[model samples]
Target: MRNVVYMAVLLIVANEIYQKPDMGLGVFMLVFTLSRQLQDITSKLLIGAAQFESDINYMKIFFDLKKLERENIDDTAELIENGDIKFENVNFSYPNSEKLVIKDLNLTIKSGEKIAIVGKNGSGKSTFVNLICGMYEPDSGVVKINDINIHNNLTAVRRSISVVFQDFGHYEATIRENITYMINVGMQVLKNYFN
Candidate 1:
Protein backbone atom coordinates (compact mmCIF):
# COMPACT_ATOMS: atom_id res chain seq x y z
CA MET A 1 0.00 0.00 0.00
CA ARG A 2 2.76 2.44 0.93
CA ASN A 3 4.76 1.44 -2.12
CA VAL A 4 1.78 2.09 -4.37
CA VAL A 5 1.32 5.57 -2.89
CA TYR A 6 5.04 6.29 -3.37
CA MET A 7 4.83 5.19 -7.02
CA ALA A 8 1.76 7.37 -7.59
CA VAL A 9 3.50 10.41 -6.10
CA LEU A 10 6.53 9.76 -8.32
CA LEU A 11 4.29 9.53 -11.38
CA ILE A 12 2.58 12.80 -10.49
CA VAL A 13 5.92 14.49 -10.02
CA ALA A 14 7.15 13.16 -13.35
CA ASN A 15 3.99 14.43 -15.06
CA GLU A 16 4.35 17.83 -13.46
CA ILE A 17 7.96 18.07 -14.63
CA TYR A 18 6.93 17.05 -18.18
CA GLN A 19 4.10 19.57 -18.32
CA LYS A 20 6.41 22.36 -17.16
CA PRO A 21 9.66 21.94 -19.11
CA ASP A 22 10.94 25.17 -17.49
CA MET A 23 11.39 23.20 -14.24
CA GLY A 24 14.55 21.72 -15.83
CA LEU A 25 16.53 18.53 -14.92
CA GLY A 26 17.69 20.12 -11.67
CA VAL A 27 14.11 20.26 -10.28
CA PHE A 28 13.50 16.62 -11.22
CA MET A 29 16.77 15.51 -9.56
CA LEU A 30 15.87 17.45 -6.42
CA VAL A 31 12.44 15.82 -6.23
CA PHE A 32 13.89 12.33 -6.83
CA THR A 33 16.61 12.82 -4.20
CA LEU A 34 14.06 14.07 -1.68
CA SER A 35 11.83 11.07 -2.37
CA ARG A 36 14.73 8.67 -1.77
CA GLN A 37 15.58 10.43 1.50
CA LEU A 38 11.91 10.25 2.54
CA GLN A 39 11.84 6.52 1.80
CA ASP A 40 15.01 5.93 3.86
CA ILE A 41 13.59 7.91 6.75
CA THR A 42 10.31 6.02 6.58
CA SER A 43 12.11 2.67 6.66
CA LYS A 44 14.24 3.72 9.63
CA LEU A 45 11.21 5.05 11.50
CA LEU A 46 9.37 1.78 10.96
CA ILE A 47 12.31 -0.23 12.22
CA GLY A 48 12.63 2.02 15.26
CA ALA A 49 8.89 1.81 15.98
CA ALA A 50 9.04 -1.98 15.94
CA GLN A 51 11.98 -1.95 18.33
CA PHE A 52 10.19 0.54 20.57
CA GLU A 53 7.08 -1.62 20.67
CA SER A 54 9.13 -4.65 21.67
CA ASP A 55 10.84 -2.65 24.42
CA ILE A 56 7.48 -1.44 25.69
CA ASN A 57 6.24 -5.04 25.88
CA TYR A 58 9.27 -6.04 27.89
CA MET A 59 8.78 -3.12 30.23
CA LYS A 60 5.14 -4.05 30.75
CA ILE A 61 6.11 -7.59 31.68
CA PHE A 62 8.77 -6.34 34.04
CA PHE A 63 6.44 -3.92 35.77
CA ASP A 64 3.66 -6.46 36.02
CA LEU A 65 6.04 -8.92 37.67
CA LYS A 66 7.15 -6.21 40.06
CA LYS A 67 3.59 -5.40 41.08
CA LEU A 68 2.69 -9.04 41.69
CA GLU A 69 2.19 -10.04 45.30
CA ARG A 70 4.06 -13.16 46.38
CA GLU A 71 3.60 -15.27 49.49
CA ASN A 72 6.33 -15.04 52.03
CA ILE A 73 8.67 -18.00 52.12
CA ASP A 74 8.49 -19.90 55.38
CA ASP A 75 11.70 -19.92 57.40
CA THR A 76 11.27 -23.69 57.83
CA ALA A 77 11.32 -24.28 54.08
CA GLU A 78 13.64 -27.14 53.20
CA LEU A 79 17.04 -26.15 51.86
CA ILE A 80 18.88 -28.10 49.18
CA GLU A 81 20.81 -30.97 50.77
CA ASN A 82 23.00 -32.46 48.04
CA GLY A 83 21.93 -30.53 44.90
CA ASP A 84 20.95 -33.64 42.99
CA ILE A 85 18.84 -32.31 40.13
CA LYS A 86 16.12 -34.30 38.42
CA PHE A 87 13.58 -33.48 35.77
CA GLU A 88 10.76 -36.03 35.51
CA ASN A 89 8.29 -35.98 32.60
CA VAL A 90 8.72 -32.24 32.38
CA ASN A 91 6.77 -30.25 29.81
CA PHE A 92 7.01 -26.50 29.45
CA SER A 93 6.36 -23.54 27.22
CA TYR A 94 6.65 -19.79 27.62
CA PRO A 95 3.60 -17.91 28.73
CA ASN A 96 1.27 -17.11 25.77
CA SER A 97 3.16 -19.57 23.57
CA GLU A 98 1.48 -22.79 22.45
CA LYS A 99 4.57 -24.71 21.34
CA LEU A 100 6.36 -26.54 24.12
CA VAL A 101 9.98 -25.56 24.38
CA ILE A 102 10.68 -28.53 26.62
CA LYS A 103 8.52 -31.58 26.15
CA ASP A 104 8.35 -34.80 28.11
CA LEU A 105 11.94 -34.38 29.28
CA ASN A 106 13.53 -36.58 31.90
CA LEU A 107 17.08 -36.16 33.20
CA THR A 108 19.20 -36.43 36.31
CA ILE A 109 22.40 -34.78 37.43
CA LYS A 110 23.83 -36.05 40.68
CA SER A 111 25.67 -33.89 43.19
CA GLY A 112 29.06 -32.75 41.88
CA GLU A 113 28.20 -34.06 38.42
CA LYS A 114 29.81 -32.30 35.50
CA ILE A 115 27.83 -31.99 32.30
CA ALA A 116 27.53 -29.64 29.36
CA ILE A 117 24.39 -28.58 27.52
CA VAL A 118 25.06 -27.83 23.87
CA GLY A 119 22.34 -27.06 21.37
CA LYS A 120 21.35 -24.72 18.58
CA ASN A 121 19.45 -21.51 19.23
CA GLY A 122 15.84 -21.92 20.45
CA SER A 123 16.55 -25.56 21.41
CA GLY A 124 15.49 -25.12 25.08
CA LYS A 125 18.90 -25.20 26.78
CA SER A 126 18.28 -21.87 28.52
CA THR A 127 14.71 -22.87 29.26
CA PHE A 128 16.01 -26.01 30.94
CA VAL A 129 18.33 -23.97 33.12
CA ASN A 130 15.55 -21.52 33.96
CA LEU A 131 13.44 -24.43 35.16
CA ILE A 132 16.26 -25.69 37.37
CA CYS A 133 16.88 -22.23 38.77
CA GLY A 134 13.19 -21.95 39.63
CA MET A 135 12.93 -18.92 37.36
CA TYR A 136 10.15 -20.78 35.61
CA GLU A 137 7.92 -23.67 36.60
CA PRO A 138 7.30 -26.68 34.38
CA ASP A 139 3.85 -26.97 32.91
CA SER A 140 3.72 -30.56 34.08
CA GLY A 141 5.80 -32.92 36.21
CA VAL A 142 8.58 -31.75 38.47
CA VAL A 143 12.00 -30.16 38.73
CA LYS A 144 13.63 -31.53 41.81
CA ILE A 145 16.73 -30.73 43.81
CA ASN A 146 17.68 -33.52 46.19
CA ASP A 147 14.25 -35.09 45.65
CA ILE A 148 12.53 -31.91 46.84
CA ASN A 149 10.57 -29.94 44.29
CA ILE A 150 12.52 -26.81 43.27
CA HIS A 151 9.44 -24.57 43.53
CA ASN A 152 8.92 -25.72 47.12
CA ASN A 153 11.81 -23.51 48.23
CA LEU A 154 13.29 -21.59 45.32
CA THR A 155 15.69 -19.51 47.45
CA ALA A 156 17.38 -22.67 48.71
CA VAL A 157 17.82 -24.13 45.26
CA ARG A 158 19.05 -20.86 43.81
CA ARG A 159 21.64 -20.42 46.54
CA SER A 160 23.00 -23.89 45.83
CA ILE A 161 23.21 -23.50 42.05
CA SER A 162 25.75 -21.38 40.20
CA VAL A 163 25.62 -20.50 36.54
CA VAL A 164 27.96 -18.66 34.17
CA PHE A 165 26.10 -17.62 31.07
CA GLN A 166 27.71 -17.31 27.62
CA ASP A 167 27.03 -13.57 27.69
CA PHE A 168 28.31 -12.98 31.20
CA GLY A 169 29.33 -9.47 32.14
CA HIS A 170 32.89 -8.17 32.07
CA TYR A 171 34.24 -6.32 35.07
CA GLU A 172 37.12 -3.90 35.44
CA ALA A 173 38.58 -5.73 38.37
CA THR A 174 40.55 -8.84 39.36
CA ILE A 175 39.05 -12.23 38.57
CA ARG A 176 38.26 -12.80 42.24
CA GLU A 177 36.56 -9.43 42.50
CA ASN A 178 34.49 -10.11 39.40
CA ILE A 179 33.51 -13.56 40.63
CA THR A 180 32.48 -12.22 44.01
CA TYR A 181 30.86 -9.03 42.76
CA MET A 182 27.29 -9.86 43.74
CA ILE A 183 28.19 -12.40 46.42
CA ASN A 184 27.56 -11.30 49.99
CA VAL A 185 29.75 -13.98 51.61
CA GLY A 186 33.11 -13.15 53.14
CA MET A 187 36.42 -14.03 51.51
CA GLN A 188 37.08 -16.77 54.10
CA VAL A 189 33.80 -18.46 53.21
CA LEU A 190 34.67 -18.37 49.53
CA LYS A 191 38.14 -19.74 50.28
CA ASN A 192 36.66 -22.59 52.32
CA TYR A 193 34.12 -23.39 49.61
CA PHE A 194 36.81 -23.42 46.89
CA ASN A 195 39.09 -25.61 48.96
Candidate 2:
Protein backbone atom coordinates (compact mmCIF):
# COMPACT_ATOMS: atom_id res chain seq x y z
CA MET A 1 0.00 0.00 0.00
CA ARG A 2 2.79 2.39 0.93
CA ASN A 3 4.59 1.54 -2.29
CA VAL A 4 1.49 2.36 -4.31
CA VAL A 5 1.08 5.67 -2.46
CA TYR A 6 4.73 6.59 -3.08
CA MET A 7 4.40 5.80 -6.77
CA ALA A 8 1.24 7.93 -7.07
CA VAL A 9 2.93 10.85 -5.29
CA LEU A 10 5.96 10.55 -7.56
CA LEU A 11 3.76 10.63 -10.68
CA ILE A 12 1.91 13.73 -9.40
CA VAL A 13 5.23 15.52 -8.73
CA ALA A 14 6.63 14.52 -12.15
CA ASN A 15 3.48 15.71 -13.95
CA GLU A 16 3.52 19.02 -12.14
CA ILE A 17 7.23 19.52 -12.92
CA TYR A 18 6.68 18.81 -16.61
CA GLN A 19 3.51 20.94 -17.02
CA LYS A 20 4.29 23.96 -14.86
CA PRO A 21 7.54 24.46 -12.93
CA ASP A 22 5.74 27.18 -10.84
CA MET A 23 3.62 24.42 -9.29
CA GLY A 24 6.76 22.62 -7.94
CA LEU A 25 6.36 24.15 -4.47
CA GLY A 26 2.78 22.79 -4.05
CA VAL A 27 3.90 19.44 -5.39
CA PHE A 28 6.74 19.32 -2.82
CA MET A 29 4.24 20.12 -0.03
CA LEU A 30 1.88 17.34 -1.24
CA VAL A 31 4.71 14.79 -1.32
CA PHE A 32 5.86 15.84 2.17
CA THR A 33 2.33 15.47 3.61
CA LEU A 34 1.82 12.09 1.95
CA SER A 35 5.20 10.82 3.25
CA ARG A 36 4.33 11.85 6.81
CA GLN A 37 0.95 10.08 6.54
CA LEU A 38 2.64 7.01 5.18
CA GLN A 39 5.09 6.96 8.09
CA ASP A 40 2.23 7.24 10.57
CA ILE A 41 0.35 4.43 8.83
CA THR A 42 3.43 2.22 8.82
CA SER A 43 3.98 2.77 12.53
CA LYS A 44 0.35 1.99 13.28
CA LEU A 45 0.50 -1.20 11.22
CA LEU A 46 3.65 -2.35 13.03
CA ILE A 47 2.10 -1.67 16.44
CA GLY A 48 -1.07 -3.50 15.49
CA ALA A 49 0.90 -6.50 14.23
CA ALA A 50 2.86 -6.63 17.51
CA GLN A 51 -0.34 -6.43 19.55
CA PHE A 52 -1.91 -9.24 17.49
CA GLU A 53 1.13 -11.45 18.05
CA SER A 54 0.90 -10.88 21.80
CA ASP A 55 -2.84 -11.67 21.81
CA ILE A 56 -2.24 -14.86 19.80
CA ASN A 57 0.40 -16.00 22.30
CA TYR A 58 -2.00 -15.38 25.19
CA MET A 59 -4.75 -17.29 23.36
CA LYS A 60 -2.45 -20.27 22.88
CA ILE A 61 -1.68 -20.24 26.61
CA PHE A 62 -5.39 -20.10 27.45
CA PHE A 63 -6.16 -23.12 25.25
CA ASP A 64 -3.18 -25.01 26.66
CA LEU A 65 -4.38 -24.35 30.21
CA LYS A 66 -7.88 -25.59 29.34
CA LYS A 67 -6.46 -28.72 27.75
CA LEU A 68 -4.35 -29.48 30.83
CA GLU A 69 -7.31 -29.12 33.18
CA ARG A 70 -9.74 -31.25 31.12
CA GLU A 71 -9.32 -34.44 33.19
CA ASN A 72 -11.59 -37.39 32.28
CA ILE A 73 -10.89 -39.47 35.42
CA ASP A 74 -14.15 -40.70 36.85
CA ASP A 75 -14.83 -40.39 40.57
CA THR A 76 -14.70 -43.62 42.55
CA ALA A 77 -18.08 -45.28 43.23
CA GLU A 78 -17.04 -45.95 46.84
CA LEU A 79 -18.01 -43.11 49.13
CA ILE A 80 -15.61 -42.07 51.91
CA GLU A 81 -18.09 -41.33 54.70
CA ASN A 82 -15.57 -41.81 57.51
CA GLY A 83 -13.38 -38.89 58.52
CA ASP A 84 -10.39 -41.01 59.58
CA ILE A 85 -6.96 -39.74 58.40
CA LYS A 86 -3.37 -40.85 58.80
CA PHE A 87 0.07 -39.79 57.55
CA GLU A 88 2.90 -42.22 58.15
CA ASN A 89 6.62 -41.53 57.46
CA VAL A 90 5.56 -38.94 54.90
CA ASN A 91 8.39 -36.99 53.27
CA PHE A 92 7.64 -34.19 50.85
CA SER A 93 9.43 -31.42 48.95
CA TYR A 94 8.00 -29.00 46.48
CA PRO A 95 8.86 -29.11 42.78
CA ASN A 96 12.45 -28.00 41.96
CA SER A 97 13.24 -27.61 45.67
CA GLU A 98 15.81 -29.65 47.58
CA LYS A 99 14.69 -28.59 51.05
CA LEU A 100 12.52 -31.18 52.80
CA VAL A 101 9.34 -29.35 53.78
CA ILE A 102 8.01 -32.27 55.80
CA LYS A 103 10.48 -35.01 56.81
CA ASP A 104 9.70 -38.21 58.62
CA LEU A 105 6.28 -36.81 59.52
CA ASN A 106 4.00 -39.33 61.21
CA LEU A 107 0.53 -38.62 62.64
CA THR A 108 -2.91 -40.17 63.02
CA ILE A 109 -6.39 -38.78 63.72
CA LYS A 110 -9.36 -40.96 64.60
CA SER A 111 -12.75 -40.62 62.99
CA GLY A 112 -14.95 -37.87 64.45
CA GLU A 113 -11.83 -36.36 66.07
CA LYS A 114 -10.77 -32.75 65.60
CA ILE A 115 -7.18 -31.52 65.82
CA ALA A 116 -5.27 -28.36 65.00
CA ILE A 117 -1.81 -28.13 63.46
CA VAL A 118 0.35 -25.43 65.05
CA GLY A 119 3.53 -23.90 63.66
CA LYS A 120 4.99 -20.58 62.64
CA ASN A 121 5.30 -19.43 59.01
CA GLY A 122 7.01 -21.80 56.50
CA SER A 123 6.79 -24.73 58.94
CA GLY A 124 5.28 -27.32 56.56
CA LYS A 125 1.80 -26.80 58.10
CA SER A 126 0.24 -26.11 54.73
CA THR A 127 2.19 -29.01 53.20
CA PHE A 128 0.73 -31.38 55.77
CA VAL A 129 -2.76 -30.18 54.96
CA ASN A 130 -2.13 -30.59 51.22
CA LEU A 131 -0.87 -34.12 51.85
CA ILE A 132 -4.02 -34.97 53.77
CA CYS A 133 -6.21 -33.43 51.08
CA GLY A 134 -4.58 -35.63 48.39
CA MET A 135 -3.32 -32.55 46.60
CA TYR A 136 0.24 -33.83 46.85
CA GLU A 137 1.69 -37.33 46.98
CA PRO A 138 4.43 -38.40 49.38
CA ASP A 139 7.93 -39.02 48.13
CA SER A 140 8.21 -42.46 49.76
CA GLY A 141 5.45 -42.78 52.35
CA VAL A 142 1.73 -43.38 52.73
CA VAL A 143 -1.31 -41.21 53.57
CA LYS A 144 -4.34 -43.20 54.64
CA ILE A 145 -8.01 -42.77 55.49
CA ASN A 146 -9.91 -45.70 57.02
CA ASP A 147 -6.83 -47.87 56.40
CA ILE A 148 -7.28 -47.17 52.69
CA ASN A 149 -4.31 -45.52 50.99
CA ILE A 150 -5.31 -42.04 49.86
CA HIS A 151 -3.31 -42.38 46.63
CA ASN A 152 -5.43 -45.43 45.76
CA ASN A 153 -8.77 -43.59 45.97
CA LEU A 154 -7.73 -39.97 45.53
CA THR A 155 -11.13 -38.90 44.18
CA ALA A 156 -12.95 -40.48 47.14
CA VAL A 157 -10.39 -39.03 49.56
CA ARG A 158 -10.87 -35.58 48.13
CA ARG A 159 -14.64 -36.00 48.36
CA SER A 160 -14.26 -36.70 52.09
CA ILE A 161 -12.06 -33.64 52.76
CA SER A 162 -12.98 -29.99 52.54
CA VAL A 163 -10.83 -26.88 52.90
CA VAL A 164 -12.06 -23.33 53.35
CA PHE A 165 -9.77 -20.53 52.36
CA GLN A 166 -9.85 -16.99 53.69
CA ASP A 167 -11.12 -15.76 50.33
CA PHE A 168 -13.49 -18.62 49.58
CA GLY A 169 -16.18 -16.97 47.43
CA HIS A 170 -17.11 -14.07 45.21
CA TYR A 171 -17.90 -10.76 46.97
CA GLU A 172 -20.27 -9.43 44.33
CA ALA A 173 -23.09 -11.81 45.31
CA THR A 174 -26.00 -10.61 47.46
CA ILE A 175 -25.87 -11.19 51.22
CA ARG A 176 -28.90 -13.47 51.17
CA GLU A 177 -27.44 -15.54 48.34
CA ASN A 178 -24.07 -15.73 50.05
CA ILE A 179 -25.52 -16.80 53.37
CA THR A 180 -27.86 -19.43 51.90
CA TYR A 181 -25.38 -20.62 49.26
CA MET A 182 -24.42 -23.58 51.46
CA ILE A 183 -27.52 -25.37 50.16
CA ASN A 184 -27.85 -23.59 46.80
CA VAL A 185 -31.58 -24.34 46.90
CA GLY A 186 -32.86 -25.83 50.13
CA MET A 187 -36.21 -26.94 48.72
CA GLN A 188 -38.08 -27.29 45.47
CA VAL A 189 -39.99 -24.07 46.12
CA LEU A 190 -36.81 -22.05 46.54
CA LYS A 191 -35.27 -23.74 43.50
CA ASN A 192 -38.33 -22.86 41.44
CA TYR A 193 -38.19 -19.25 42.61
CA PHE A 194 -34.46 -19.04 41.71
CA ASN A 195 -35.14 -20.61 38.36
Candidate 3:
Protein backbone atom coordinates (compact mmCIF):
# COMPACT_ATOMS: atom_id res chain seq x y z
CA MET A 1 0.00 0.00 0.00
CA ARG A 2 2.76 2.46 0.89
CA ASN A 3 4.72 1.47 -2.21
CA VAL A 4 1.69 1.98 -4.43
CA VAL A 5 1.11 5.48 -3.08
CA TYR A 6 4.74 6.37 -3.65
CA MET A 7 4.67 5.01 -7.20
CA ALA A 8 1.50 6.95 -8.02
CA VAL A 9 3.11 10.17 -6.82
CA LEU A 10 6.25 9.48 -8.86
CA LEU A 11 4.18 8.76 -12.02
CA ILE A 12 2.30 12.04 -11.67
CA VAL A 13 5.54 14.01 -11.39
CA ALA A 14 7.06 12.11 -14.33
CA ASN A 15 4.03 12.91 -16.49
CA GLU A 16 4.27 16.61 -15.65
CA ILE A 17 8.04 16.67 -16.40
CA TYR A 18 7.43 15.00 -19.76
CA GLN A 19 4.69 17.52 -20.70
CA LYS A 20 6.98 20.51 -20.11
CA PRO A 21 10.73 20.64 -19.59
CA ASP A 22 10.49 24.28 -18.29
CA MET A 23 12.22 25.64 -15.11
CA GLY A 24 8.91 25.89 -13.10
CA LEU A 25 7.80 22.29 -13.83
CA GLY A 26 11.33 21.03 -13.23
CA VAL A 27 11.52 22.84 -9.86
CA PHE A 28 8.07 21.52 -8.85
CA MET A 29 9.00 17.95 -9.76
CA LEU A 30 12.27 18.18 -7.84
CA VAL A 31 10.54 19.49 -4.67
CA PHE A 32 7.71 16.93 -4.90
CA THR A 33 10.09 14.02 -5.42
CA LEU A 34 12.31 15.15 -2.55
CA SER A 35 9.30 15.42 -0.20
CA ARG A 36 8.05 11.92 -1.06
CA GLN A 37 11.48 10.36 -0.59
CA LEU A 38 11.96 12.17 2.71
CA GLN A 39 8.64 10.76 4.04
CA ASP A 40 9.59 7.21 3.05
CA ILE A 41 13.04 7.55 4.62
CA THR A 42 11.62 8.89 7.88
CA SER A 43 9.10 6.04 8.09
CA LYS A 44 11.81 3.45 7.60
CA LEU A 45 14.06 5.13 10.15
CA LEU A 46 11.37 4.97 12.85
CA ILE A 47 10.69 1.28 12.18
CA GLY A 48 14.40 0.51 12.27
CA ALA A 49 14.80 2.33 15.56
CA ALA A 50 11.99 0.30 17.15
CA GLN A 51 13.47 -2.99 15.92
CA PHE A 52 16.90 -2.10 17.26
CA GLU A 53 15.49 -1.30 20.70
CA SER A 54 13.69 -4.65 20.82
CA ASP A 55 16.87 -6.51 19.81
CA ILE A 56 18.85 -4.84 22.58
CA ASN A 57 16.26 -5.79 25.21
CA TYR A 58 16.31 -9.43 24.05
CA MET A 59 20.12 -9.54 24.16
CA LYS A 60 20.13 -8.18 27.70
CA ILE A 61 17.84 -10.98 28.88
CA PHE A 62 19.88 -13.64 27.05
CA PHE A 63 23.12 -12.50 28.64
CA ASP A 64 21.58 -12.36 32.12
CA LEU A 65 20.33 -15.95 31.82
CA LYS A 66 23.73 -17.12 30.62
CA LYS A 67 25.43 -15.49 33.60
CA LEU A 68 23.09 -17.29 35.99
CA GLU A 69 23.78 -20.65 34.34
CA ARG A 70 27.50 -20.12 34.79
CA GLU A 71 27.05 -19.21 38.44
CA ASN A 72 25.18 -22.44 39.22
CA ILE A 73 27.73 -24.76 37.56
CA ASP A 74 29.75 -25.33 40.71
CA ASP A 75 26.95 -26.61 42.97
CA THR A 76 25.65 -28.86 40.23
CA ALA A 77 29.08 -30.43 39.78
CA GLU A 78 29.50 -31.11 43.51
CA LEU A 79 26.12 -32.87 43.71
CA ILE A 80 27.17 -35.18 40.88
CA GLU A 81 30.19 -36.34 42.86
CA ASN A 82 28.65 -36.88 46.33
CA GLY A 83 24.95 -37.33 45.57
CA ASP A 84 24.14 -35.39 48.75
CA ILE A 85 21.84 -32.41 49.21
CA LYS A 86 20.29 -30.56 52.14
CA PHE A 87 17.81 -27.82 52.78
CA GLU A 88 18.14 -25.99 56.12
CA ASN A 89 15.17 -24.02 57.43
CA VAL A 90 14.37 -22.99 53.89
CA ASN A 91 11.34 -20.85 53.04
CA PHE A 92 10.26 -19.90 49.52
CA SER A 93 7.45 -18.24 47.61
CA TYR A 94 6.98 -17.25 44.04
CA PRO A 95 7.64 -13.67 43.08
CA ASN A 96 4.71 -11.24 43.54
CA SER A 97 2.72 -13.87 45.39
CA GLU A 98 1.77 -13.77 49.06
CA LYS A 99 1.48 -17.51 49.55
CA LEU A 100 4.51 -19.46 50.75
CA VAL A 101 5.36 -22.62 48.89
CA ILE A 102 7.95 -24.19 51.16
CA LYS A 103 8.02 -23.08 54.76
CA ASP A 104 10.88 -23.84 57.09
CA LEU A 105 11.56 -27.05 55.23
CA ASN A 106 14.44 -29.16 56.55
CA LEU A 107 15.77 -32.14 54.67
CA THR A 108 19.00 -34.00 54.09
CA ILE A 109 20.35 -36.76 51.89
CA LYS A 110 23.51 -38.81 52.33
CA SER A 111 26.08 -39.47 49.68
CA GLY A 112 24.91 -42.20 47.24
CA GLU A 113 21.47 -42.08 48.78
CA LYS A 114 18.41 -42.55 46.62
CA ILE A 115 15.41 -40.52 47.65
CA ALA A 116 12.03 -39.66 46.24
CA ILE A 117 9.79 -36.71 47.05
CA VAL A 118 6.11 -37.50 46.83
CA GLY A 119 3.40 -34.88 47.02
CA LYS A 120 0.03 -34.06 45.57
CA ASN A 121 -0.38 -31.32 42.92
CA GLY A 122 0.45 -27.83 44.21
CA SER A 123 2.13 -29.30 47.25
CA GLY A 124 5.43 -27.46 46.74
CA LYS A 125 7.43 -30.35 45.27
CA SER A 126 8.15 -28.52 42.01
CA THR A 127 8.94 -25.34 43.94
CA PHE A 128 11.47 -27.24 46.04
CA VAL A 129 13.20 -28.48 42.90
CA ASN A 130 13.23 -24.99 41.48
CA LEU A 131 14.93 -23.74 44.63
CA ILE A 132 17.60 -26.39 44.30
CA CYS A 133 18.21 -25.51 40.65
CA GLY A 134 18.73 -21.82 41.54
CA MET A 135 15.63 -20.81 39.59
CA TYR A 136 14.18 -19.19 42.71
CA GLU A 137 15.95 -18.06 45.86
CA PRO A 138 14.73 -18.99 49.28
CA ASP A 139 13.04 -16.25 51.20
CA SER A 140 15.27 -17.31 54.11
CA GLY A 141 17.58 -20.10 55.30
CA VAL A 142 19.84 -22.10 53.04
CA VAL A 143 20.09 -24.84 50.42
CA LYS A 144 23.36 -26.73 50.66
CA ILE A 145 25.03 -29.13 48.24
CA ASN A 146 27.43 -31.53 49.97
CA ASP A 147 27.21 -29.28 53.05
CA ILE A 148 28.28 -26.17 51.09
CA ASN A 149 26.04 -23.12 51.08
CA ILE A 150 24.52 -22.67 47.65
CA HIS A 151 24.09 -18.93 48.15
CA ASN A 152 27.66 -18.24 49.22
CA ASN A 153 29.31 -20.31 46.51
CA LEU A 154 26.72 -20.45 43.79
CA THR A 155 28.96 -21.90 41.07
CA ALA A 156 30.48 -24.46 43.41
CA VAL A 157 27.11 -25.44 44.84
CA ARG A 158 25.54 -25.76 41.40
CA ARG A 159 28.46 -27.91 40.20
CA SER A 160 27.61 -30.49 42.86
CA ILE A 161 24.13 -31.20 41.54
CA SER A 162 22.06 -31.94 38.46
CA VAL A 163 18.29 -31.92 38.05
CA VAL A 164 15.82 -33.21 35.49
CA PHE A 165 12.45 -31.58 35.90
CA GLN A 166 9.37 -33.64 35.13
CA ASP A 167 7.95 -30.73 33.14
CA PHE A 168 11.08 -30.25 31.07
CA GLY A 169 10.55 -29.72 27.35
CA HIS A 170 12.18 -31.45 24.41
CA TYR A 171 13.05 -29.00 21.70
CA GLU A 172 11.70 -29.33 18.18
CA ALA A 173 15.28 -29.20 16.95
CA THR A 174 17.24 -32.19 15.74
CA ILE A 175 18.31 -34.97 18.10
CA ARG A 176 21.98 -34.19 17.51
CA GLU A 177 21.55 -30.60 18.56
CA ASN A 178 19.73 -31.60 21.75
CA ILE A 179 22.32 -34.19 22.67
CA THR A 180 25.16 -31.83 21.82
CA TYR A 181 23.75 -29.17 24.11
CA MET A 182 23.54 -31.65 26.98
CA ILE A 183 27.07 -32.91 26.37
CA ASN A 184 28.38 -29.40 26.23
CA VAL A 185 26.81 -28.76 29.62
CA GLY A 186 28.40 -31.92 30.96
CA MET A 187 31.81 -30.84 29.66
CA GLN A 188 31.34 -27.55 31.48
CA VAL A 189 30.71 -29.52 34.64
CA LEU A 190 33.96 -31.44 34.11
CA LYS A 191 35.88 -28.22 33.66
CA ASN A 192 34.46 -26.89 36.92
CA TYR A 193 35.54 -30.03 38.72
CA PHE A 194 39.15 -29.90 37.50
CA ASN A 195 39.49 -26.20 38.15
The numbered model that scores best in TM-score is 2
Model 2 RMSD vs true structure: 10.9
Q: What is the lDDT of residue 177 in candidate 2?
A: 70
Q: List clashing residue pairs in candidate 2.
A: none
Point out where model 2 deviates above 4 Å: 1-65, 70-72, 167-195
Clashing pairs in 1: none
Off by over 4 Å in 1: 1-71, 77-81, 167-195
Q: Which of 2 and 3 is the better model by TM-score?
A: 2
- Which ten residues in a row are the worst by lDDT in model 2? 185-194
Lowest summed-lDDT stretch of 10 residues in model 1? 185-194
Residue 69 lDDT in candidate 1: 57
Better of 1 and 3 by TM-score: 1
- lDDT tens digits, residue span 3-110, model 1: 786788778888998999898889877877888889889999999898777667645754565465554455444446576889999999998999999999999998
Each candidate's TM vs. the true structure? 0.52, 0.53, 0.51
lDDT value, residue 64 of candidate 1: 66
Report the alpha-carbon TM-score of model 3 versus the true structure: 0.51
